[model samples]
Target: MGQNLANHLVPSQDYDLICENLAQTKEGADILRLKGGIPLANLETVTPQLKRLKIGAVLNGKELAAIGKILRSTSEIRRFFKEITTPEVPLPTLNQLLIRLESLPELTKVLNLSLEDDGYVRDEASPLLRSLRRQISGTEDEIRQRLVSFTKGSQAKYLTNAVVTMRDDRYVIPVKTEYKKHFGGMVHDQSASGATVFVEPKAIVELNNRLRQQQAKEHEEILRVLRELSQEVAPYTEEIDQNMRILGQLDFVNAKARYAADLKATQPELSAENDIYLRQVWHPLLDAKKAVKNDLAIGKDYKAIVITGPNTGGKTITLKTLGLIQLMGQSGLFIPAGEHSRIGVFTEIFADIGDEQSIEQSLSTFSSHMVNIVEILKHVDDKSLVLFDELGAGTDPQEGAALAISILDAVGAKGSYVVATTHYPELKAYGFERPETINASMEFDVETLQPTYRLLLGIPGRSNALEISLRLGLDTMVVEAARQLTSQSSQDLNEMIADLVEKRHTAEEEAISLNKYLTEAEKLHNDLRKAYNNFVSQRDSLLNQAKAKANEIVENTRKQTADVISDLHKMQQSAGNGVKENELIDAKTRLNKLEQPIHLQKNKVLQRAKAKKIFKEGDEVLVKSYGQRGTLMKKAGNHVWEVQIGILKMKLDEADLEKIAEEKPQKTVNRASVKRSRSVRTSASLDLRGKRYEEAMNEVDRYIDEAIMAGFPSVTIIHGKGTGALRKGITEYLQSNRVVKHFEYAPPNAGGNGATIVSFK
Candidate 1:
């Protein structure tokens, strides 16, 4: 979009809504100006630093937000402090400056006392400022004590109420109307009913006088403090101003993000290819819930599309959606479209949309449109997006259609993308006559007599005048007569359009029915597949249960046979000559037969174990408990192995030895790729030579994780001990990492306090 396009879009429906939203996020006028300012001349060459400020607050013994607001305002600061007395340096306008400095940091090196998130300078800028505040607090306490004593004394009788209230910054008591003369002090104010008077008693007059004196001193001291703060700020006025500008830019950017979120917008791919392919794009100006999303393509084969439709059928809105979204993209705002949408960088965008005629300039609608089109044609190029509405509709139909065609040809010759809306029948044929243009229309329901607002491409629209007239109760004879009066060719074209719309509508219904059936079939297929899987799982579970029971029975039978054989042997030994050798042999044979099944089961279990066993005599494995890698020397026993780790052979459980995949030869990496990877790597060491405190702290987190993953025994972080902030932050982070066994400052021979060495567990 061109620089001039914003003005055209600002007047379009809801386009300015975006600008208003951007204005709301800004905190101050300085930022608003920066957001509204003209584009930079050359962004590539601009390296100006953004202005920034650190602030602290002065608590006046309250947590009231209103008081905080007053304290933060530039106008309030100026009113309270009055003017600086010293003539050494001139201060900037106080009403625009947020703070006034009285003493330099040399008197008190303090800054960054946050009062609020929007950011305001705290009153405690220096040590002198803090000291003066303390004195004020003490004086206020004394005054409160004096007022309490007086209210409890003889004056308690005259006092309408014992409560003390302040009037014009002076501690006052409410006295009864009849006893006003008894109080030998000035009356400040009276109640609305005049039933009582607020007075400062003469008895505490001396205390009040002392309090006043202290306040005067406080005021003077505050002015001095503000002047000192102002002096510090004066040196960096440029930086402060720039900070405001950058903050405002960010505020606007954030607003756009919020607006895009509301619209469910996606970021569009940008290109200089001079093509636009939009999908599921809804007009931001229209109600998104009801809006019919449409697809539009331009600068691909065709340079222009002539859209025609009945009145109020959304041709104009489609044009506006195209124009507005393009402007939004060029201005760095997200477009409300699908991820497939792409936008080309156009140097200029021209629009003759709506009725932009100027009566004050004595330009009729046609003349006004022509004047805009002439300017557009003179400057439009292959990189421009030009739009027109109701093109050539305010003049004679024949001449207007001719002129519209001529203009489309001109734009096409220049290779610029153009979209125009028209109601002229002759103009509808222009799209067919020109190879670089196509026709589109908004769909309308013939039966409901309502516009669908659905843009249908590759289709020309009909006027539908006769049908509307007939529906409005016009004489059927007159409507029929009007249709017959039109040329045969025109009548034939209208008949063809009617037939085409009917066929498309029927096809759409059939397609919808077919889709519904397909969806149902797919659901049924998924359900059957899920049922089959469940059946297979149940069958496997039952089979495993049966196999377990059979094994249990075989073990029990073998145990019984062994016990019986043992008893028989005992009996035979005791009864010396009673049993024959054959009978004893038969008993042993029976025992062997019972034990065969147990032996076969045992052999099957051994075979399965042998199938899964990973370690061999020569295979290398890692001993996790000892954190060492070694080869398996031999198999010691069931579920255990003898492994040699670092020349020491020990019997270990198989679970203790983890199988390590043999390392493959490292793939050769190009020298350039190695350098690139290193530049982006956070390895066993991190060097924060010149980074800020925040950046250095963040980098430390990534550095530690990389070192642990790389299996480094120890890692070093170099954060030069400048003011010790960076070093302190890095050390604190290192302490939080669970992987670190210990960390300490490097020795003097190394980087000393400038670097920390950490050992990982």
Candidate 2:
């Protein structure tokens, strides 16, 4: 699908990789092996064809290869297929392959190829064919049995081996060179050493005649059968060829889809109304585990982005990713990016991206770049994507910056999406001046003095030439002298840009820190909520249990009271109102004692647990059961105090807080240090075996989240060997996950390779 601009948009190396991933069958491979892009319309039929192929099981490689050969013209297949013999692909294979072709169903159904000998026309192809084969079988058997008897009787000693062997398709026996005249009817062949002769016995000569006659008749019958089958097939050869062509196209499409799957690539959102917005986009040509992700936006805000950074900070590579991803997307190939990445279909993509200064072309670097740019301008339109690397580089700085800005303006006037990279400070300043253009920078770590490879949008980059020179053993006097030579405005601008870069870095670091803490706080909050609910539930359950037991005791006490009262009443009745007052007093006392213990137990169980200790602002307090420390901001009405820890704030119950001695207070967790600590104890992989699908994925999600937050470049997942359901589920999850860049099966010796190694962005 991407044959036209491929040469310009992708390097030769990357083009080869894309083609390699797009080929399956030899025909498909041959088609992909071509250097140029095919028209997009040519790929339209591929979808339905692919859906058809996808419904069937994977075809055998040999069978697929053979079938692919049928679509090749005789001239194209000449090197591999000689004119002397035609490949007699069995009818069954052809029929099996063409099972879905409506026109050839009848021919395919009646074609019996089960008894075909190695794809050759079968002896049971027809009744006449079967009769001819029967005669041959009978005659051959008679010859073999007679020969076996002869060898066993006396000729066994003369033969090299006792079994009958075929020479020139005729049964023969190996006899000693000296004894050849005695045993042979006709010497069919001789050994290279002249030590043995393969001969037909005189006794079996007549039998050989009969077998040869039958074989001749069988050959004729086979030809007749073949002719009959060929006649039936000839009428539908066009349809058969068409089906093969469709199959090959499907194979190519499937190969691309499979490759995308392997690379964890996604079909980016296609937006015709907007310019490109690539989120966490990575170059498919680079190693997924190592490639840094970048967020890029062109249009909807600015039509062009001028990226600047140190050499090899991916300034050039960024240009290439944008160009290649556009080409890939328009070509119906998935891009290596996160979901929600939007790419507009470019009518044309023109790239002057690499150092095309050709000595052989007798052109200087600037001339070559200008030459390509001139050509690019001629064809660029509103629907085009233009990529330029170090625009106007091989020239004077003043002229180059002016030229670059002008080129961007010209391309922008065409309404084309434009991206260019340059180190010129003047160009960086121009980015601020232009209303339709913005500046982006590749981040560099000041502490490690290395490239972080993170692309920061909306900030210009400063050339760290002075700082780098000073750090790399340059004399302070020389650096100061160089600084003095530069204008005050230039120096001031450089300082401002450097400060901005540093501040941006700090801001990003703070964000990551905030994220980590928020996650921890959330987890802690959930745990606390769970524990509190459990405590309340258990308390209520215990209270219910206690009240139930008390009720039962009260019921027994009431029964006793009733019995006492009844006895009193009986006494009154029996004694005519002369009941015993002592018995009634004793019964009431027993009832009072039973009710007293219940009141005391109820008072103990139902007591309110409010804080007695006073806590105020600036106090270091521990959130009980949370194992976290926070500073009290203020008391919020009745016993609820607001606590602050870093960016986290919450109102906690008085009982949930315990004032802690400021000495040896709960230390704040350092996110960077937490990330670095993975070097100490974290294993590179997480194993999820024998867990249910939901349970396994839940654990996998947490494991991956922790790994990402820990700043792991990559990690492994061991889901054990099974029916591949677990691996598939995990893979799908990874594909949709924001943290995962890409994933692959682990190498051997790391549990089953069904266990995948995941990379994080």
Candidate 3:
């Protein structure tokens, strides 16, 4: 099926649509590769049954089963497409083919219930059929039982064998001819030996007759079921037929996709300007690993290319590669070419390839070729791609070269795209002289005496006849004699071509080296960009945290100050004349404690200083200037150490270095131990809304210590705004505490003033 579809060629006017289908095919192949594979192996074409159904013809069980299998495949394929399609890469073309497809589960269910896997109607297809079969089975069982009883009874002596058998669908027993009258039953059949005659006893004959009648009824029931099923299918004949066609088209597309993947081929782009460009294109039929790839382009810069080279140097292969690739593209199959290859749609493609000599017509090779060329000349126009191999070869060199040149000119005059291969040096010169024409060659390795099969555009191939002879150990005298006999103009032309080949080789090497460097540079640029973005993101996060902490501390301090002043005024009003000494002393003590937080705030640098610890080389330490951890390289000077952070190296004061310990795997803990230390693992917030003032203060103290140990940046204390007593108390405590860097209310959405958020130093 795949081969048949691949061999088909669509019309030129449908080239765009064909290309679209090829693109869709390639996409489907890629998805199938990722999604395990397509589940279309069991999908059989039911076109025949579908046609029968279209004409309202009754189909048998097998035919219906075939159509059922196709419906099952349709559902599977549709589900596959739906599952794999994504917004990022939707299969627009493939999904379009499924627009009319539906999951008619009821119809599918009915068919599946009625038929077996091989298309035979099941006994349970209908209640009447089931009942009829059951009756037929029971009657056969009764007949067999009656015959068995006879074999065991006194009448068994008349039987030649005690086995019961059937003759023409009725049960009977074999009896000796002499005892046949004793059996007293109808003779159904006689054995090969006349001594035995098969007959049914009178007693079971009635049972056999009843069984036969039941079987006949069973047959009628099966036929009636099949006819009903066919009628059920008739209503949907047009839809089912359309579905079969769509399924076949999808299968064809999938096959092409699979073949393309095997070839590692790419779909060709439609050239808007009749231009052809194929890079690293190889003959599709040739082994890709062994076949040398080449670039072939024409129609854009030049209307024609004249490839001249020695025989068996891949010149003919080049012509075929171009023509075959173009044809494959037109047929909606991917070509064996590199990505970005473009192909022009041609109204006609003419080829005069290989030997076409005719013994019957007595025509020479040249004449035969002329006949093909004449036909091409008459039909070719600006939209045709013409390929000729060994053009103008089977004749005198002088006449052949001139004739090849004239033919090329004639084709070019028509503006038709042409590619031809020849071995004539005159044609090489003619290529350079002609307008809209270029000369190309198949590369040859002179030392190895083998063709490299590399096509070199803008250069003519050299005939290394003398070089080959010398390499084969031909006498130097012969080679020198031949070289001396060569014309000076020919000698000059060969030398010029050799020099050009050498220059092109050097230039290609340089281009390859430059491309390698460019790739590395681009990769480095991307790495640097990513690293810069990460650095900026980390820096912003840390700065925001620090700013929030500072603002909270300032706001809490102001609130605490206002509360203390209010308390002092109330105390004075209650005392009237004077406050007690103890009470006055208590107030002074509270005021003195407040000074500690102020001192810490003033000496922030001292508060942030790390404990003294000896540092050594290879130890990880935090670089204060960069706020990043780095490996300690060495001591640069007294109280100075050099650190390596990422790719940067820096020397900083020892005071800036804070040694960081390497983390080790922790030992497994017991659940009981975790519960015992629950207070040590404090949460980010505490609730003090219902607690007494004294108890709440104590809880706040313990929670703050736990939060600090847990490395919490800030914690919320939920003290209801009611009575303003708890809020005022917590704020005053936070303000006087040296470790409390900040305290403030959370946002309105998060408990607002009822919650006090605290940050530790």
lDDT of 2: 0.67
- Highest lDDT: give the candidate number: 3
How would you encode candidate 3's per-residue C-alpha lDDT over 490-606 as one tens digit per residue? 667656766775575466556546877899999999999999999899889988987897788668767777776788888777765554433443455455444322234446575
Per residue, candidate 2 scores C-alpha lDDT tens digits across 146-243 of: 88976786778887767788787788888888888887599999999999889988988888888888888877776566545544544454565565
Of models 1 and 3, which has the larger TM-score?
3
C-alpha TM-score for every candidate: 0.51, 0.52, 0.66
Instruction: Name the Cα RMSD for model 2.
Output: 28.1
Q: Give me the runs in candidate 3 sitting further than 4 Å from their true place.
A: 1-13, 87-89, 148-165, 173-184, 191-197, 444-454, 472-474, 484-761
Error of 1 at 149 (Å): 3.6
Clashes of 1: 19
Which tens-of-lDDT digit does each residue in 466-563 have in candidate 1?
A: 88889989999999899888778866765676576457545645654687799999999999999999999998998899789889978887787878
Q: Rank candidates by TM-score, best first.
A: 3, 2, 1
lDDT of 3: 0.78
